[model samples]
Target: MSATLGCFFLSMWLMRRRETVYGWFAVMSVAWWICGYNQVATSPWPFRSTDGWEIANTVSLLVYSASFTVFILRFCDGR
Candidate 1:
């Protein structure tokens, strides 16, 4: 996760040079991922499953989905 976040921030920093909306979206995604991941960690699950990891996983998924959605929208707009 740290590596992933690190790469994303690196990309964002690069984007800052070009100054695209992707840079802002990256910031938003990172913020949401961090906040949601923490919430997931404190959540309770009843059964023993790899899915026992809820908070971080859910947050990660949502962040991925949101990022993908943005990518799609940008692609559709011929970005």
Candidate 2:
């Protein structure tokens, strides 16, 4: 669902590049999807150690948080 929403938002952004909120939302959604998938997946391939996986998860979380915050700020400010 998150990935779908991300693609939707990405398409929306592509349609209107001036509306950066949509771009940010797309980024946030994709990051959230990554985080969610990491949680559900049994193994984190391409990463040998748990530490690497943890780092990737943390980075995704940070991206989600930052993009969400920016999206909220831009969205609210536009109104």
Candidate 3:
């Protein structure tokens, strides 16, 4: 959890610097926090299954992949 918070703040700082990659960092941090919240302590009152965390983790991966793909394309195109 602390690690996630650290990354989240780092990403925020990067975003403040206007780094495009930090957009993905921010998205992944949010997803990571959602996933991590499921395991650290008591479950929230509404959630019954771990499915939501799994989905959040999966979404994080997808966002990462999509961002990498876009970054690569832009780099190759000199954009």
Candidate 4:
């Protein structure tokens, strides 16, 4: 679902280049997807250890929060 939303928003941004909110929304969606996947995955295939996985997950969550805030602020014309 998050992937689909991210792709859809990305395509929307591509079609309407002037609307930057869509781009931010796409970023937020992709970050959310990464976080969600990290929560549900069985193993951390790419990471060498649990510490790396945790760090990556934490970074993704931070990205998700930042992007979501940006998306909301942009959508509301707050910036």
Local distance difference test, candidate 1? 0.59
Question: What is each predicted model's overall lDDT from 0 to 1?
Answer: 0.59, 0.94, 0.58, 0.93
What is the Cα-based TM-score of model 2? 0.93
Candidate 2 Cα misplacement greater than 4 A, ranges: none
Q: For model 1, how does the per-residue alpha-carbon lDDT over 1-79 read when each residue is reduced to its tens digit?
A: 6446646765976957564445545655664665555555544444355465655567667776766676566546744
**What's the TM-score of every candidate structure?**
0.39, 0.93, 0.43, 0.94
Worst 10 residues of 1 by lDDT: 41-50
CA lDDT of 73 in candidate 1? 67
| Candidate 1 ranges with C-alpha deviation above 4 Å | 1-9, 12-52
Q: Give one digit per residue, the lDDT tens place, for model 4 in 1-79.
A: 9999999999999999999999999999999998999868888879988889989889999999999999999999998
Scored against the true structure, residue 10 in model 2 reaches a CA lDDT of 100
> Sorted on lDDT, highest at the top, how do the candidates line up?
2, 4, 1, 3
What lDDT does candidate 1 reach at residue 79? Answer: 49
TM-score leader:
4
State residue 15's C-alpha deviation in candidate 4, in Å: 1.5
Best by lDDT: 2
Candidate 2 lowest-lDDT run of ten: 37-46
